[model samples]
Target: MSTTVTQQPQHSTLGEYKRWLRVSLYTILLLTGQCTATLLGRFYFAKGGKSKWIATSVQSAGFPILIPLLFYSSKSTNHDFSKPKRSVMITFYLGFGLLMIAMDFLYSCGLSYLSLSTFALVCATQLAFNGVATYFLNSQKFTALILNSIVVLTMSVILIALNTESEDSTDLPKEKRLIGLFCALAASATFALQHSLLQFYFEKVAKTGVFSVLLRLNFYPMIIASVGAVVGLVGSGDWRSMGMEMKEFEYGNLELTITPILAVFVFHDKIYAVKIVAFFLAIWGFLSYIYQHYLDDQMANQDRSDDGLQVLKGEEQI
Candidate 1:
């Protein structure tokens, strides 16, 4: 008689759970930070603060927040992350830092003119930009759902562009509104490129471990960007006007306009039918991309489970 027995690997399940838990935590943190930062950044411009460089500086200058998290070591894993030479690391970090400065500066320009609602809607195109970057850079599969997302997002942009005159989010002129649109789109594209470069660096060059990820990908580059922002601030002499800008600005709610809905009440941003349509389209596109990502994650986990089962079966062989 022949008998076969198998034992499930409990460790694999635990590890997968931990990985997902970490991912969830990171996602929540990122979302919170983005909303908070956007609200405050837009607030700066809303109150007649004109220095784009200062706003740009504040974005990356908050690198100190990551210090404790970055330094906290965790137990080692089987994955051996690459450790590039210091000089090489410097070059890589500087490249990203410069790119980030330009990205932030453009975003600042966008916020300076566009209302919070309009700005947020434009920012939604960021994911669409990432989709394009992934298609070209990683050669990721062009699935139907993802294509739908990209097309829908493009339509959202067109919706806004078509009704340029009546979509008055702010008291700004049509020319300034157009400028905001351009700046926001440019910033989105720049951010997509930055994201692609970061992924490429981690996957191909750095192979940085999860624990040390922020140090190279964000901390170093942000420090360099902060310096660039400061230099621009001083060089442009915008720092001189900041004192009066802050003093003369009319003060209002601190956390009032955290979203587009709130912007109607807080910033008095006008709502147009076209913008309403665009917002819905943007939301649909965003949801489509998120669903596609969820599907991708499911497939990845299933493959990992299959590999783990194969290993466990081999080990249990009689």
Candidate 2:
């Protein structure tokens, strides 16, 4: 008698390894996309004279797409919009959006003088600012570990900023460096305040379906920014001038790199090796945060499972 060996259907350890590998690989790609978008935004702003028009036009085109995405995500998550919390939710969204627009505009104004790398390094102080702000806001308790992390994060930012400036000629005036420092500090404050406000909204009002909350929050500021752009054009008597300028300006089709990257290569930064290292450091820091969050979630799930097992054993004993 010939016996047939039956193969059990199961995911091998290699399969699990591949699943994690894919997740990590996708995370890096997502980070790359975020970093590229951030770099390109500064590049466009730095290009000055007419690139503002390009930024404004691109933002306008992208705004409409978010609305459909918002609705779809909300539906997928089974979010109830008619829950009678509309008034509070709308207020929170508007407040958050307005705050973001104000902060962003201020940062943009400051960027006319600061280098992209300088701004990125300076922005690294956000963790410190957030910790201090959270303490004052009474939104979260700050532990010694949190305090130490903030101090270290702040020191690293200061060192990075100083190093960048020192590499510039010593003969360079003090006022410019001072202005950069001040702008960076102010930017950090704005960033921290925005975070505090957002945390409050997320915890209190818009708890379900974060994507829907993001959609509602984004919609108002987007409208405000569009209006601001139009007013800026008309106020400067450059509405006609902008149109004429757009004719000569070449906005490239959506590609791997936006128009700004090409502009940076051609007209602005050379993208040094050191800056590449800093960029990687920033990306690593962000990924570390995501990893920590995943760990916390897993712990919570394990606790819930243990609680359920204890309850089952008690019921079986009875």
Candidate 3:
């Protein structure tokens, strides 16, 4: 008689869970970093800080800081980071980098000319533009939920825009206000397009660890954006403006350092009901808008059918 031996597949449920936990933690940290960076950039521009190029370059600093984290994570997972790295095309990166630089410059200009509140309201339009860009770039289908979300979000932004217009009792000059409005719209569109392009690259081009992918996505663009900023800084003679920005850097930099810890706490506490509700409401509003459009289309079709029947009956009578 002969005996046979079989090997069972190894299960690593705990290992998988640990990986998930790490990814979640890192995601929270990144989000917090993004919030802080945005707030700091906005605050700096709001206070008459004229070094838009420097501000843009500072925001790109987050990318390099994450490189080591990504490398370690990849190593822990036994990923072959040494493999020939697949990346987005150079042409795409160059074009995307230019767009990012333009968007940042426009956003800085808008912040300089407009109040923070107004600029924020205008920035919300990016969500709507994102939908359109995703549809075109990523072949994202417009399901009812997505359509609803877009509609509601757009309506909310429009209401905010109207409110800002009504409350235009500010000391800002008309020319500045108009320029700010144009810059805000342009910035929103460019940002949405850039985001869409990034989504495409991540989905199609990148073949690396998550950290590596993110680092690559941000690092090269940061270099390009830094170059643009340096050119602008020299061209505008705003190199001296850095001193003023640094003097008031406490306003935003401190928040950047603190927010990551606060974000961790918020993630652990689960005290986010209000934000959840608001998010759902936006989705609900979008759904209703899409449903309404659907109904209107149906009604128009019915009216055309009725007209056709009447025309047929008149022809029979004649």
Candidate 4:
């Protein structure tokens, strides 16, 4: 009877392993799709035309699509928005949004100096930044795994920086290009902080679906971004000239416009070896995260089951 019981548990464990595997695979595909879309958008932005507007335009215009997803997720999760710690949520958004603005503004200049592939690699430093920021903000002690990830990521960053060659034939100072990398690092830091803040909110305050939380989080920032975009256009004195005659700029979202521009002006071709490697690295990192999360969850479940079994056994013995 004990052997049969053990076999049943083994079968159950196998089932969970399979389920987690499937989820991990699905998550990888989702990440890849999103990455592809973002890469295409970046390409358009590099094309040096009205396509630059695509970034802000898509951000604002995509609110409608986001809304439905948010609503459905909130319903599915049974998340009570009203029960959230309002003060904490407010502070989080305020701090995160300001950092995002600063990062974006800083990169607005750096983008002029760096190549798309270079920038993409620079952005990947966020994983390391998140670890550092979490230590400072949450006072979380790092485990060996986290420390190792940071070390590996740091090495990758070094490799990428060393590998970068100036393709721009313009008379821009070499020092300015070097400075662009630091700016990109600063942007990555801000992104990491923002993510850490959101993770804190979801775990510590009120557990909610990512879709709902993201929608709510984006609401104020989107307004700020829209205002900033409008102001930038006016301040540049190119308000009248920008995106007016270009048939490509007619779309509600700028990312779509940016895609073609990037393809034509910046990257100028299909996938390259380095980019393919980067993509795989990103996917691997993402899978590692999912696996770690699943392991934690399994341990928690095992602890609960053990506790329950102990109590039942105690009653039987009594």
Off by over 4 Å in 1: 1-18, 74-81, 165-167, 252-265, 312-318
lDDT by residue (tens digit), candidate 1, 45-108:
7766678898899899889888776656423433466677788788889999999999999999
Candidate 3 residue-wise lDDT at 227:
80
lDDT of each: 0.81, 0.58, 0.63, 0.61
Q: Answer with 3 or 4, whichever has the higher TM-score.
A: 4
lDDT digits (tens) for residues 1-318 of candidate 4: 345445856776888789879988997997776466556544444544432333444434444556677667768864445557778777766665566566565554445456666666667777778878887776766766566666666665665556444343322476866777787788788778877777777777756645667677877565565566566656766567655635444333354645464443445434445555555565455445445556667887798768756766677678
Order of candidate numbers by TM-score, starting with the best? 1, 4, 2, 3
Error of 3 at 45 (Å): 3.3
Question: Among these predicted structures, which one has the highest TM-score?
Answer: 1
Task: List where candidate 4 sits over 4 angstroms from the true fold.
Answer: 1-26, 50-57, 70-82, 85-88, 103-111, 138-140, 162-173, 207-214, 236-238, 244-302
User: How do the predictions measure up, each by TM-score?
Assistant: 0.86, 0.67, 0.62, 0.69
Candidate 4: C-alpha RMSD after superposition = 5.3
Pairs in clash, predicted candidate 2: none
Quality of model 3 by C-alpha lDDT: 0.63
The lowest-lDDT stretch of 10 consecutive residues in candidate 1 is 1-10
